[model samples]
Target: MNSNSDVTSRTVTALGPQLRRRKSIKHMVGEAESNSGQLRRTLGMWQLTMISVGATMGTGILVILGAAVPIAGPAIWISFVIAGVTALLSAVSYAEMAGMVPVSGSSYSYSYATMGEGIAWICGWCLVLEYAVSVAAVAVGAGEYVNQTLRTFNMELPVSLAGGPAEGGVVNLPALIVVVLATLLLVRGARESAIVNTVVVIIKAGILVFFSIVAFSAFNAGNFEPLLPMGAAGVTAAASSVFFSYIGFDAASTAGEEAKNPKRDLPRAIMLSMLIVTITYVLVAVSAIGAREWTWFVGTEAALVQIVGELTGQPIFVLIFALASVLAIASVVLTVLYGQTRILMSMSRDGLVPAVFGKVSKRTGTPVAGTLITGIVVAITAGFIPLGALADATSIGTLFAFALVGVSVMYLRKRQPQAPRTFRVPLYPITPILGIFACLFLMSQLGWHTWVVFLIWMLVGIVIYLGYGRRRSRLGQLSKQDYIASHVGENQ
Candidate 1:
């Protein structure tokens, strides 16, 4: 049997010169400041957990119930369970990796340490798609809810400023406004983002709990009698649609660098947030199902608000629901925007993306340039694209990234047995394998157009890698250094 020392030696030697060069470049690129400006380390386990919940629970639970219910009927509850379990598995995988690496880049940095450069670039690209597009989708959803809320007071924005291009509008000014506000908050630092997120999360949760209580009073047992009206396949399909709600679990992982004790805190945050979200979802699903027959849920936008209005017989409930939706969706945009900028910063550090992305503002100690660029792209997407289309596309990209992270955990266990890990996936091979399969299952249920768009995005990433990233990569340089170092040591 190989001794521990032997394993350590092999691991170090296997790092190769390319890794060293990459490390050197990362150090150089990250030299701007050790302090992340005024970003306070005030976030504890509770705050981090809430941040995850804030980011995940928004438009998904409040808005998506309508879309998903039509597909699976009362079995939408089962869809929530299925999606929750699958997401938990992947969240555990993320916890382990984030604990081990404890960096700002989330999956991108984890892949860099375990899977090498080319794979890391692909992971980073996928993350950009996942975070930026999801933010845009959430922003668009927020705009709709805001517009709906305003109309209740007899005030209305022009269609061009409220709706997307697909809905007979040239641009969505409200959506662009949402992205810009989130960007400004994020540029200030993590502490401000956390404070704002915490407040928004509380508001959103209170509204949901209120809805659940009020709607439950009107529950009719007969409403759920034909629970599986669409069968098990329908439940599975609905679960796939519901999986979008779970995409933000990775949001906590992106804060690895700012986390007080990353290894200990990350796992707690991921698991706790997921568990809370699952419970919240179950409550909302039960209330929605019990309030009315499953079929009535079809074709409704902002379905939770509709459920509330039906139960209370008051338009005031709709106004409150819309307000809750705005706060929740805005929180999602902020968290995801912060995540995308960090991933870009990591890629820039590795020389896989333009160095400008890696630049830290001396005053802010944040990746201001990357944040601005990401915000601009998301604003444009939200301004022109419909929420439904963007949601599907975001889900595909997110599932792909989740699948990669799960696979990476298993791969790293075999390839880097000696790497330090503060937390391990409880079931090891089984956990990660299940996570990979679950992600694939969800991806399979998405429309073919989503798959086509995802492929095109990946192709674009590959092209950029070949044209620029490959030549400038610090990984290649590090490998060369390791080879030379080994030979020199041998000669001596």
Candidate 2:
């Protein structure tokens, strides 16, 4: 009995540090405010809303519509609603969390505080894939559209100089150029990026509206003959793709720390931006299909520009549409790239990734190192890899992140009922539960190859966590009270 007791005590003592590791809500928030070398809180509600709009309305609307329309015919509009609703549900939960926490990591920090370090790491990992790869994907789309715009001027580059080999281009220099430009914008500061994003958003919105009016003039009811040409399965499958457009509303929440009034503005920006984007998407979808048969859009390089060109036979309109696409896609890349570095900065602050990612430049108040690293990786992916099915892969990663965020909201509600909340998710558990189910349903519609890749990526995250992050986690290094006390001491 004595021998057994001794062994048990030894084991318990050995496991104490690991077992006691806790990333509490308060500690996480304090770490963000005091220790992260925080970002400047310069963004107003409108600027924040524009970030969401700019990020959400880009490549998916401009490019994916060409690919998604044939799958659901004219009924691709319904898929937009379905995807939009799912995104809104998740956004509601995100709004509540963003209001209450108002931190930089977005869902990753929420998960860390509500769940545990392990789940938080996974969430952060998923976001890295979602933001970085989505940026790369959008960059490629932007490059293609820029090339199209140049062609209108009869200044077309060789296919070899335009894109990767898969897209029949050797290097995709234009895509690389846009990524580098976006990187420079981000490294300068978030406020400057937001200013540029706002201007881009206005220009893109104006062009989209103009095209919609023209498209409606040429609208033919014949395009509606068979709305569900590919059936319900096809609509749902396309919803899984269209869901990409909805992904960026959450980018607003990622800027919680930088919001001048996060508790008030973050939630408002989230819901408002999503509303604007949903309306814009519906108008564009209706106009595109009504103006031309859905079949006409399939496989087209610049579908919207082609629609406008076909409608008016005007090279000027094609030029305008092409310019809008380039601006819109560049803004998406900027916003998402900004969001990516912030997540990585948060992860680095928590010691889940390299310390270099955590370092914020005093002059710019930005994560310069992480921004450069992300920019280089995104540029390479856009320059070399053909984005065949990667958009679907990115959609899956985003859905997984959304599901976890919904789960985090519910978890926090139950675990910290007394925690101060500036906003609450509507309908309690139903909203969050629906958000989770919707994400899972959409995720199920993704192809098996996407799932395999996602699994492999997650497995790699686990290996990295175990090897480096698990022991090195900042939360592991400090006791909960110690962290709180340190912050209190600093304030005093």
Candidate 3:
């Protein structure tokens, strides 16, 4: 066999050395903090929750609502609840794994120590798709809102600078600009980014709350007459579509290495962020339909503006809502981009990618190189790709990653029955099994085109693993030592 084939064949064996090759719980705990030049543990529960909150509460509500209300009618509020419940299953699994592993790779690192190197690579690859594409998708929506706000002031930008070729534009300048700004903020430092995120989250939440109050004042009970206009199927489809908003609660777990008290605080942050986001979404959905007819929301990108304009005949409120949407989308881009870079850094540390990505800047305590690389790639993608299909890809990628983390929690419980765990998934295997199935059910609701794209992405990941990552893995070196130790035990 050639050297590459030799490496690929043995990569599966990396999982078999559970007795000798498994990373001990204690080792992972120390590694989370002992590397003096590594990511600093500076985030507490509040900052970490804001990262998840700021990331989760963006374009999903502002953009997806326009597309979803036409299908689910006034019953769209039920869709939000369904999506939130689905997220909660995987989230509990995340809490358990984050508390146990306490590392930067999120699901990827948890899979490494429990499942094996190959699964870890695939999990990490899925996360890259999730975060990077999510950033691109959010940027596109942010650009649209920014342009709309400008037009409201009688300041029109050229079509070429405002959108992609799909929208008859040469390039998406506004989308590219937001990506660059978020990247610069990320490179500054994690704590600084967290602080900015907290401020943004407060402002975004306040705007939504104010919008809800205004919407409810003009409430007409008659608007909700035909709640499930399209029936249960429509609600299910809308739930699957709206699930994109909840993807970022898991981003909190990616900051495991930078959390002050990861074990207790990580779980708290995940649950708290989810609760806050779910409540906010439900209020907005109800108030929106109550404010006007559901037909008014269909095919409209600026539903908030349209609703406010109709309510008060005032351009000022419409502009305020438009500006808030712009800022909210920008914050989502920042948080998810931060997540993508961190995941790449963790994978790089395992020799699954180039070591350059793993480089930490001592002055900033951040992965500057990875952050810049992710920024450029996402900027290009945002500047060109249309948002429709890419958004589905982000949701599918996240569901896949969540399913893997859910399974990893179950596998670890069986393999390391005595491992020290500060937190554990409630109801044992039921929680993870539900999490996995819930993700699969939602994945089934997406169109066939999304599955085709997801499969192609997975194939590319497999090729990279065989061609480059297999031979270079740091885990291989450790596995060899364990292999020799196993033989030595046999001889003894």
Model 2 C-alpha lDDT per residue in residues 66-90, reported as the tens digit of each score: 8899898889999999999999999
Per-residue lDDT value at 343 in model 3: 88
Provide the RMSD of all predictions against the true structure, rounded to 1 decimal.
Answer: 6.4, 4.9, 3.6
lDDT tens digits, residues 1-492, model 3?
467765664665543342224344455556666754578889999999999998899999988887899988889999999899889999889988888887878988887776667778888889988999888988988777887788778886798998999999988998899999999999999999999999989989998998898899999989998988899999988988999878798889889888999888998898889889999999999999998788888778778767777787788887888888888999999999998898898888767799988899988999999999999999999998776665688889899989998988888888777766777888988889998999999999988988888998899998998777766775565545554553341211
Worst 10 residues of 3 by lDDT: 483-492
Candidate 2: regions farther than 4 A off: 1-22, 35-38, 479-492
Model 2 scores a TM of: 0.93
TM-score of each: 0.90, 0.93, 0.93
On the 0 to 100 scale, the lDDT of residue 35 in model 3 is 59
Clashing pairs in 3: none
Candidate 3 vs. true structure, TM-score:
0.93
Error of model 3, residue 302, in angstroms: 1.7
